[model samples]
Target chain A: MSRPIYDRVALIGLGLIASSMAHAMKKWGLAGSVAGHARTAETRAAALEIGFCDEVFETAAEAVKGADLVVLAVPVGAMRAVAEEIGPHLKPGATVTDVGSVKQAVVAAVAPHVPEGVHFVPGHPLAGTEHSGPHSGFATLFQNRWCLLVPANADPEAVARLRALWEGMGSYVDEMDAAHHDLVLAVTSHTPHLIAYTMVGVADHLSRVTESEVIKYSAAGFRDFTRIAASDPTMWRDVFLTNKEATLDILGRFTEELFVLQRAIRMGDGQHLHDYFTRTRAIRRGIIEAGQDTAAPDFGRTKSAGD
Target chain B: MSRPIYDRVALIGLGLIASSMAHAMKKWGLAGSVAGHARTAETRAAALEIGFCDEVFETAAEAVKGADLVVLAVPVGAMRAVAEEIGPHLKPGATVTDVGSVKQAVVAAVAPHVPEGVHFVPGHPLAGTEHSGPHSGFATLFQNRWCLLVPANADPEAVARLRALWEGMGSYVDEMDAAHHDLVLAVTSHTPHLIAYTMVGVADHLSRVTESEVIKYSAAGFRDFTRIAASDPTMWRDVFLTNKEATLDILGRFTEELFVLQRAIRMGDGQHLHDYFTRTRAIRRGIIEAGQDTAAPDFGRTKSAGD
Candidate 1:
């Protein structure tokens, strides 16, 4: 472990990102010590048992006391309340960052509460899983992943230090305005997620197509949608509620395009369908060439393709 | 190798499914010899280079002349023409099956062209990749994947033989009526694919969300949709056109459900969104438990999840 960058780190949430951050920080010695707080006693106990936290506090206020870096890793909906509770306790000149998916909401919720001389940087790590909870964490979760930091008007030293911490933990950092981050995330994440959840929900509700049939035949294409739809509900619910405008704007665009293709299907317009489908293929090639996803067919359709 | 199940197998249209079938049949000795015919000379040359076909024919009629089993592996739109071209040339008592994603359309298109004594069984293999063409086939593409056979009054023994051949190629076989097969596939594959194509298209159209950002942040959710969207455009276009009624039916359902979700999001109905999102998760759990997909998180987020 290298010398500590932050004398003390306080993480105020015990979910996937927070738990991961704690472990990553400990592994790299980025913080002298890590303290954490969660709403429930069980999560607090589990965080300590998982050995990611050096101390577990009963409240967010207690957790942030004297900490050099305070990370609000709670859901977006919970950020404002947590910020209010911890604002008075934050150390002067301390850097506060968040791991929320949407940036604008978190910034709006947390920035007003930041004390003078404190740095409030809203950040999002585009890495996670369907699973959640304190137990679902690993140090390598952010390795090679993109971590967007929106440190709106924060001191350069604080932003640089935060970037260093993420880089030290294995992430490539990019800075963007919170609004742009929300728009990009809406297209790349929120809208796609809503579509997946809708498809899976439709499958569940269709009486003619039995659940067993949907599950059994999932490997065809529905399985990928299901994999995405299975992500943590609370986390996603907050994401949609917080990023409402951009997500709705994207949904509108998607609906317009979907109607055109839906009309093509209704009218047997093969050329329109072919043209749209072919155009989309170029983007997939870009993603693969950018090394964002596996080029393996069926995403490495190995022995585990089925049981 | 096992004794040849078919004395000679003719594959019409050497794409991923057809080419894979040829190589798999030869590898497992399920056919004494494999002959293939595609619409283009380039594909025929590629098939010969790939060595999946024992002989490449210039015409479907020439390929099926002496074959005991003829596989109509072209797009759903082309099945009827291929069947008509080879109808009189098909050997007496031969078995004809197809590898189309939709079945009712294929059965309607090809069954009428079958000679009285030649058996025709419609089939849909629930296995493939985004890549197509002769060069894209792999012998193990069908291994451990499901191949749903839509048997419509075909001879019992002929259906059994087709099932055995598919089993020999390492696919689990199931039989269903053609219309039901079409409906099930519309829900499981066609509609999801259409939605994915639309979502990717929407992302591409959004000027505010730059293409670079979409590709850069795709791992969050959009990457999975892109993978599905990358599938062969012509094949999918034909599928949507051929399975129009059933796909249109699913699209209606998806649109209805999506509206309810869109309304909930607009109203900030977190409870409704959470309930819907949570319910979808159960289906994902069922899919995993049923062995149709892996329980891996973020679809087993590879090393490039962030990069």
Candidate 2:
């Protein structure tokens, strides 16, 4: 096995991402000892019971003590508080990073708390399932996925070391500016999630369409939207709140495009609708070719009991 | 072995649905012989080469001759023409059914041409992958899936026989009015597909975010939309055109709900966004409980080559 990248790694939140990191670090020997902390006692207890972490601390500050790397894996809204609590406890030369969905706001909220000698890098891993919580994580969660780092004037060596840690956990790492990360994520993740939530909500609110009807007939396509809509409420809420500008901008574009398609449908312009659909099909092909998604039918989803 | 449901069955479009039906029928011995027809010679050749059909005919009219069951599996826009051509050739005491996404338009287009003593049942099978064509089918595609029959004044015996055939093919069958089926499907299928296409188009058209970036980071929720958006453009275009009112109605409600959530995000109303997201989560659980979809994360999608 390869030598551990960090002597001691502290995970400041024992949620899906952090727990997955713990498992991957253990699997690959990426870190010598993994310590964890969560705001809720239930989560801390659960993380300890899961046995992914070597030690579980009650406070963020206690978790970061003497650690070479500290990961703030809380909701983006909670990052500032966790960063402040752990700021004084972090080792002088340690690097502090986060696994938040939005980079710009996370940087704004947590960067100010880092001490002069400590390196602060904000990262957003472009991987997750709709399921959340510590138990929902697995060692292979980051395998073949991208983990983006926003160096933001941090020391190059610190950034390189952090990239190595993620790469050791089976991720391909890339570096980009914080603002660009936010805008790209808004287009790729945030806006899509919000649109899915809205569509599901519309189905819920329709009087003519019973909830049972929606559930029974969901195999027709709506079930895909529901999968993303089933994501953690608090985490997604913070994502939208913190990444407000870019998400709103994307949403604006989405609504504009939707209206044009709507008009084509209303006007009986099959050619226009067909042309638009054909163009979008090429993008799906691009994603499949780029190895971001499987090309299998229905994502090669296993049959449920109903099937 | 039990007797076959129909002595001769003709499938009038060798796409995913019809090809799957051919395989399922052959697997279960549900039909004595299956005759197939496609608009394109390439599809007809492929269907014959795949060996799912016992015989391939050049015209829908020729395929329906002497057959007790004739299935119109063409795109909704092509249904009327196929029905006109096959009407005179359909055998007496035969059943003519269609496997179209929209019911009301299909009923209007095909019902007028039904000959005396022939039964016309319109069905919408709530099962498919993002794939199409003759070879993109499997014997178990309909297993545990719903096949809704819009039996509009059809003979009771014909409806019962069709129901038995679907059940033999491993589908759970239900009966409903054409209008109700259209509205239900608009909520569950058509509107969701249009929304997915629109969102993907927005991403494709955005000048600032490169296509490569979107494809690389797609695992963060955007990939789900791409799967549905990648469905057959001609079929989807026909669906939107034929089921315009209900789809537009659902889309309108979608935009309205989206605006409310957008306002909540803009106003920093975390409570509203959180509550909305929480409510939508229940719908996903309901879908899982109903056996409409698998509960596994990311639809239990297999890792692509990148993984």
Candidate 3:
């Protein structure tokens, strides 16, 4: 077994990411003790039953009482409240971190609640799925995934220590400014989610009021957006609310580009459409080469089966 | 073994769909003989090597000679030329069908070329993946998929025989007016492709002139769009050109909805965003119930792993 990074680690939210963290810690023996808590007593019991944590607490305050490292794993909107609730109970000199999608708001909200002696290093593991809950995590979720670390100060030693913890759990850690991280994610993730949500909404309205044929004939392509649109409502709502400005900025850019294409379609400009579609194929090749995702055919089909 | 639907079937284009149809026919004994042709000698050779046709021909004219059923399986833009090439060679009273995404244009293009004694049916199978070419097809490709048929006052007996052929290959066939089929697919398939193309184009452009960093951090969600953007360029180019009006209408509606969300995001209207996202989730649930797609957790884990 590898050496443990921390004597005791506390997870303030036992959702998908936090549970995955617990599983990874256990798989790698990276933490001497892993304790966690959820917002409700039922989830705490569920987390305990799933063996996601060595110990489960009903409240965030109780969970962090003796943890050497505390991770805030709740939604961005709840980060400040959870941090404030647990701050007084945290062991002195503990490293406080997070797995929220938006790092800027998380740092601004959670940093203020950190005690003087605590190391408040804000981090966002760039791994997740549409599902949420204490039981929805896996040890390999963060395997080969990127984790952005946004430490308020340029303390190399402190950042390195935290990076080691993530590395031990099978993630590659990169350091960047919190604001830039949010903006990067706005273009890559938030804007895409918003677009997916809107398209699904259009299909739903089309299916219900316009015609029932939409769902009957959905396998053609409308089904993919539906899968993305089915993501947890509360979590996404918090995301848009917290990452408003960055999302808006990206959305504006997307709208401008979409308008140009829309006009081309309106004017029967097949060449414009063909040129745009052809251009996009190159980026997909780039993404495959970069290894951000699988290049295989989608829907979990093997290359042979997909063919 | 199941009975053959036609004594001899001729496929005018030996691409992915035609190859898949051949495999399906062979697996189900739906055709006594499958003859196929491609414009290029290489594709015909590839079709023979892949065992996609019982007899490979050098031209559409040669392929359709004496066949009971002739299927035009080329790109929509090539339908008219293919029909004209095979018109004189087709057997008297034979059933002719073309598998194209857009029905109205296909009917208008191919109808005039069909002889008086022939029955012409336009069809679109609601099934496919990112793969193309004669070698990328399988026997099960049409299983449990929808096949839309638009028969313009063609022989009812011929339509029944064709429906039986598709049904024997494990497809569910639905008949609709040619114009209606074009409009429905425009909203469901054509518009979605255009939107996905535009989104991928935006990301591709951003990745090119700006930075490769747009890809390195793609786990944020851009990876999904990349997959959609990787589809066959020529096929998608034809779809936009053939289904212009319906695609434009849906694109217009999509723009209006997108503008509202964009404005809401710009104004920081959290309630509006939240409500929209929530409504979209229900549609995803409906799609899951319809069994058109998997309801598996977007993440690779279940609720037992965590939220």
**Stretches of candidate 2 exceeding 4 Å from the true structure:** A303-307, B303-307
Provide chain B's TM-score, model 1.
0.96
TM-score of each: 0.96, 0.99, 0.93
Q: Residue B74 in candidate 3 has what lDDT?
A: 90
lDDT of each: 0.90, 0.92, 0.80
Question: Which candidate number would show the highest DockQ if scored against the true structure?
Answer: 2
Models ranked on DockQ: 2, 1, 3
Ten-residue region with minimum lDDT total, candidate 2 chain B: B298-307
Give the poorly placed runs of model 3, Cα more than 4 Å off. Answer: A152-154, A207-212, A302-307, B207-211, B299-307
Q: Is candidate 2 or candidate 3 better by DockQ?
A: 2
Model 3 Cα lDDT, one tens digit per residue, B1-307: 8678899999988877899999999988999999998989999999888887888888889999989999998989889899888888889989999889988888889998999898887788888776678887877777767899998688899999999999887778999998788878877777777777776666555542244766777776666666676777777878877788877777777878888887876677878878888788777666656656655555232232211
Candidate 1 residue-wise lDDT, B1-307, digit = tens = 6688898999999999998888788878899988889889999999888788889999999999889999999988889999999999989999999999988788888888998999998888898888888888888888877899988788999999999999999988988888888898899999999999999999998888789999989879999999999999889999999999999999999999999999999999999999999999899899878877666666655544433
- Model 3 — TM-score against the truth? 0.93
Residue B100 of model 2, lDDT score: 98
Model 3 local distance difference test score? 0.80
Each model's DockQ?
0.72, 0.80, 0.52
Candidate with the greatest TM-score versus the true structure: 2
Candidate 2, residue A144: Cα displacement in angstroms equals 0.7
